[model samples]
Target chain A: MVFTETGTEIALHAGTSCSSGTCGAGIAQNPVQSLTPEDQRMLAAFRPETVEAAVKKTIETYKLFSYTDKILVACSGGKDSTVILHMLKKFGYAIEAITVNAHIGCYTDENLRNLREMCAKIDVKLHEISFRKEFGKSLCYIQSILKAKGYDYKNCHTCGVLRRYLLNKYSKPLHPDVIVTGHNLDDEAQAVMMNLFRGNLQVCARIGPKTGMVHDSKTDHNSATKKKFVQRVKPLYFVRESDVVKYSKLHNFPVYYGECPCSSDTYRREMKDMFKSFGEQRDEVKEHIIKSFISISEPLKAHFMQAEGGAIQECLICGEPSSKDICNTCALLAKLRDNKIIKS
Target chain B: MVFTETGTEIALHAGTSCSSGTCGAGIAQNPVQSLTPEDQRMLAAFRPETVEAAVKKTIETYKLFSYTDKILVACSGGKDSTVILHMLKKFGYAIEAITVNAHIGCYTDENLRNLREMCAKIDVKLHEISFRKEFGKSLCYIQSILKAKGYDYKNCHTCGVLRRYLLNKYSKPLHPDVIVTGHNLDDEAQAVMMNLFRGNLQVCARIGPKTGMVHDSKTDHNSATKKKFVQRVKPLYFVRESDVVKYSKLHNFPVYYGECPCSSDTYRREMKDMFKSFGEQRDEVKEHIIKSFISISEPLKAHFMQAEGGAIQECLICGEPSSKDICNTCALLAKLRDNKIIKS
Candidate 1:
């Protein structure tokens, strides 16, 4: 299996054997083959052509404000993020990439190196931040502590807290009018589940193309800030995950187009597999979910506005806006540092 | 620990001495007994009395609604279901217990026996439906086929689909105004996870206090000659799982309170554990989730109603409404009778 310049062919690996059991490796098996019917149907025949189309379509679809403002792209160095960075740059959005490295051993090592290499190739400015530099210890250290103390949490907890912190920290200095996240519709749907499961309605309300719960001063981390929330937008909110994969391959982006090793140990990975196993039925299901989110969001928001709960408090440790005195990230870091097991 | 005359408490387990890597099991190692107020406040106190209070409060808070019309109560003889049946009878709702016997070895046998005994003791009419009679094969037989073919589904899949069928069949004959389910908040929250993960928004939309999306004849089954949809209601929507356990104990109702042995092999159990570990934080999360569901549900419903492309089609053989030509229940039976495995 080889990929030609076009990177077209072999979309559905159904009847045939994808010995590796991964969509990326399987699809890329014979990238040189002529586009299959399924590939043609998805218009992924011209991988390079289709990716550009999706990015262009996404931009056109969202009809965002002028690209003249400072556009910051959150780069995880993964396929989706790389593709997003490339797409933004291609579309001539005044964009710069920011990567938050949690220093999670083998996981972040390859990703960070690949991201730095991509930035060098594309000649884009990249900002890097590490968890220890800001919070005093690595996430693995913190997770071990939490585990020992009987407060077992998933790795996503550490990743989420740090990533969010970095996003805010980076955005604050640059003061971008809007921050662009590589959150595709599927990612948004997943977040909807996380938010729904966590019962964090107010935070979820501000998760769409626009960001933040209310337009009140409580959400604004800085009093001198232009707006209460830093208008986070999703350019690829409507783009499919498969299309993103095609685009990454076509654009010759350096992305670790595979699931994180630890992710398989999670229930979410089970859901992801379920989604992957489901043939074509997923698009409609996702569309329904997005529309569902759109349905009660306004009423729920209004209810929140009418509620008597106080405004978001500033985290005493980090100054990030939080419902509690300490922010989630800081708390996570502290727990990690405190919980080191002296295994002799 | 000695149980009172009321059949709630019991004398603590005597002669327990074991050493697991995490914690040693001994009366001296009991944290509650060892710790003073300061140290104890830091850890969770699993008090039976507090659990009882929480359970009682949970039910009373939401049991305000008392339906005078005919109500069909779904019973599994499990702790949650039995407790619900007891509560509904106590509340004096015009209701009867309906159980679907999936015919899985000792599980369903014990379930039926326990359910029958409870109904006899409580003097309530118990309606039992068997899958072997209805579909011609036991659930255990169905499960073997699904597992052999690597269907990548849980036991809950067969049971869930079969339960819905049985509920409708029983509810239709009775012409019950509402089908009352023992779907407590925890179950609802987990369901919300399942629906979102699979992007089954229409089903989620169908999931509310009393209304579900069944208007579409192609996707949702219309079995009753009188009504197209069963007006389903949850009297225990706000009830907590811990409370349900406590309530079951307090009432001394004969129930198989332990979890379904099969649930341990499922992904949902993982989710349940994740939620359980959150402790009190779990409720805040559930409230936010309920709010989120209630938030965009209506507009999302309209979105789905407007663009709902597929419809539930009736099975050609059994004439049950199904998404495919054959209903899932029928498909299970067919699979059990034979060994061919091609997912529709």
Candidate 2:
């Protein structure tokens, strides 16, 4: 896990790499023989075996998944998602891949191409849900129309809400035991800091490696909609973004190494910058934040949950389990429809 | 507040200025006649009258002080402390001033002179505590010795610990209702951010406008040292550091404008810089952090306190109340003495 300014290149041990197909016949023959001595040294220090052990530790520590359970890897065709998918497949998890395409022009195309290519190589089925087919309009069209009508929000908010709604709605038939995301250490730390800064404790209570909607056959028996809420996990929770990038590149996954143009979360970007700067001085900055959050998470969750009052309601429009009468997705859609921006 | 890149000069309504003596006979006669229209507008937007109202509101909101209670202002001769002391005095509070002279070369002299002049002008009794006299060594001497021994700590840490120990020990005899320090919004926000970054929850739990030493008379029944612990308050907890500087200058309070030569809290400085940048975009940035912390402080305090467990012991060396057998002050002193650099 050697962090470099220009490029991130992690060196995994030959044994683990071989077992995981990270150093398959193709790469093993070529072996990024171009790595500098410095990079090689860094790679040796943070071997793949070490990173693999950490990933395993995180999974075990959080009880994120079971071997018998069906796992759905949420692939974005990005470095993080691709790396996670590759690792899980190599580790022999009963996993498949899903990509929710926002249909953001060339970016969407690139993502699809890369994702399809990678899935084909790994012999895994790739499932994709597009915004145009599901919502009758591309994310860009909806966002632009809203912007023209003076909507005070970035596209990311709308895209994220729709994507989450679509993921749950579309993945229902799969009956996955868990939904895995590519939320690495950097992303998780940024979220924790953001929630703390915004004084959003209720949201903070919901954050952890294995946190999301927990589907229980007995507890959720009264509400049919609650059954749609699947448990989500993150095997890459302890893995650094740098390590993910290095791993992805080293394995030659067809990853689109570009940021989303609609990444309007300026606050999150600032947090990432802070993490990067602090990480230069100490590598444990991200780990400290995550570990500390875990330590107090139970008490924090209990306190906030008690304050918020546990009352779940089904969204009137979508029949999704929500804290409010209308789910966030339904509320957002109502706003879009009111402005006559998003087509039905 | 109109955060400027070059300087921060706040405007005050003449009415409020007269009461606080900020517009003394000399300044009132001319009234910063050289201030440009832009500066005047900037000042008008962030007037002392408005700031005073906020201070009053915070006091009322937090129940920080009462008219019947005796208050001691911890004056550091800096802008923040000087402004606080002046405001409390003007508000007709039963207040006196205390200045701990760290005896850091010329810096100490400047602080003492300014404190003396301001106290004399305000007709308040000023108490002086010197590290050289009490600790048998100047803070500079102690810090230099510690540094020579490869002790990786900033001078501010040692200074802060010794100053706190002295303030509690000396102010104990006064038996004041509250000891107010000039920790403004910026300082408090920086501390909260630092604690979060450093993963220091126990320290974070001990933060807020009115937080410190909870004096339980029953718990201290058998321990004389425990009785010395006083409740510390910060009236300027909602006030920004820049505003304090402007208020100090406007009031013409004799204040040392120079930063301490040994002010080496790099992390704190970084946080300050971050605040300054964010403040330029949103003046309420500091307020936002403080408010957020306040919202979570109770639960956070409860969670951390339960984890820490309330266990207090008297220091073997100094007989002061401590979490361990040796108090922080004694521990620091022991480290300084270990190198055998301090004179007997």
Candidate 3:
């Protein structure tokens, strides 16, 4: 039996053990002695079966992937992504792992080490990409340069644009049928709210369990670029974040338990706290939010799809799929080069 | 100068004194000694002109009401409603006030007293309705009866349905062009979130500055009943709740500052708190929520309107406008009577 962060003592599976001590070392070191009433209530309600059933149901309902498909799992070295990667491999799928090292101080360094060890143990071929190698600068350095140039975007915003660009660009050579992300229900719900709060319904239209599934065949301008851009699916779309944490602990995954150092975005932190507050009052608040979003998502997609005729455009500089003449990554790169922050 | 709840010291409008003494007695009784950093920042940013400009813009932009229109303001004796009523009268609109006394212990009693005095002071005709005279029981008594019958519903839900029904039914005889409400930006933003969280997009479709403006003339079944149901408009749709409080204090309106005794619903309280948290981070967060909601509200309304053909129906029992054959109020009343909790 091992005590989790919520002070719940969980028994490991009968035959399962962390043969590699690195995987379960973090949990063993930090055995919480006390928990708040809310934590106790949440931990007491944790059911492994419920979480597994949700993942299974999401995959089958959404028809996310097939046995014949070669899946590429994006490992963020966090609990959510690590759990998804392990689950997909255990399910006997043809799978490989890919990660982007943005070099956010010691946070990324520890995560990368943990991810490398975890992948090698599972016998999965792990591919690594780095911000320094690809963009000639670490994410922090790029952010600092941009800040000096008076282009002050949040760290997550800059990193997100770059990471997505790299993931798509690099995955093409691997030729995977689909890219799998570990975005749980909590993440998706937060995204729905953030987009709504930012008046970005068109962006909201592009998210779901099967990302980028909604396409306007007639109006879309870049069918060629669309073919180049692989679809992404989320198997954990219906699972909760706490469930992911519980699953990660139960399986003894070697995952960094800390948040990204640069992810202190006030808006997202506020949203995360808001969800926690709402969840305490209604246990299924996250599920309700996702369900409501899904109900309206189709109409939202259809409306915007038809409204923005010739919606997708190939980036003039990088030849990548974009909503405008230039993709976000290329635009940022152009800004950096124009300010002589980075050599062209 | 008077110190407000947020610890903001404000000078009252020049020559505008609380000569009656009862109007500003609440503020005079106790002054806040200290303020949190958030409260200090919010108070520092208070501009009465900005609030007035928003209200004026909402009225003009939405074409909510005209000078010739007979406006019946729904006065709840709360700061929001009181401010809206005073603003409309000051704007030179022909206005009167109507209030419902739910008899929620001392809360509604005090509110009713304040409503009467404020209406008399403003030289507006005051119309009062009571649950005992209209429904044969007070709201609290009815709630207890329903709870005893094992039909437990939140007080706000029950009260909202009955109050809306009474407002429409009673306002018809007043021959007003429109029934004005005090739903401000914060309230509307909360409703948007609540409806989204509850997966009640159909209900969300019916809300806006000009409530119930989205109608399908071809598909609507109850044109006659609709005519009987006076439309409700919100002139303070763009104003913030805090601004409403400031406006009320500025004018020294006699208003009850406490919340309704029956309004301890956890879901709404959570939403309100979430907005407050978001507002602390971004001052225009509420505005963004409302703007995003408005952008998609038209499509939301249009989609649901067409989907729900014959959208409006006259309640079979009461002949009031409803979305179903039997209205919520009648359906609830039927349950109470059928359980023998309340005499028919």
Best by DockQ: 3
TM-score of 2: 0.81
lDDT-best of 1 and 3: 3
True contacts kept of each: 0.49, 0.38, 0.62
Q: How many angstroms is residue B61 displaced in model 2 relative to the true structure, after the best TM-score fit?
A: 4.8
**lDDT for each residue of candidate 3 in A1-344, tens digit (9 for 90 to 100):** 23345534232311224222333323222324334466456667677677777877888898899999999999878898888888888878899999998866556666787789789989999999988688766776677667766888889988987787788878999999889999998888888787677666666665669975334565455455457578789999988787898777656577767566577764677778877776564437667777866777767766675565534334765544345778677888678668664464
Report, for every candidate in turn, its global Cα lDDT versus the true structure. Answer: 0.61, 0.70, 0.72
Can you tell me which runs of candidate 3 are displaced by over 4 Å? A1-63, A132-138, A148-151, A212-216, A224-228, A281-283, A306-329, A338-344, B1-63, B132-138, B148-151, B212-215, B223-228, B281-283, B305-328, B336-344
lDDT over C-alpha atoms for residue A99 of model 2: 92
Residue B197 in candidate 1 has what lDDT? 48
- Would you estimate the TM-scores of all the predictions? 0.57, 0.81, 0.79
Query: Top model by TM-score, which number?
Result: 2
- Please give, for residues A1-344, the per-residue lDDT of candidate 1 as tens digits: 22234433222222333322442322233344534566456554545665577567756665553667888888888887888888778777788888887655555656787789889988889999887566554555555545657877787776676577567866778887677778787777666655565656555544555553224564444444334347667777767777787676655567666675445456455445434544576666555666556655654454454452533445566544455677676777666556532111
Task: State the displacement of the C-alpha of residue B256, model 2, in Å, after optimal TM-score superposition.
Answer: 4.7
Worst 10 residues of 1 chain B by lDDT: B18-27
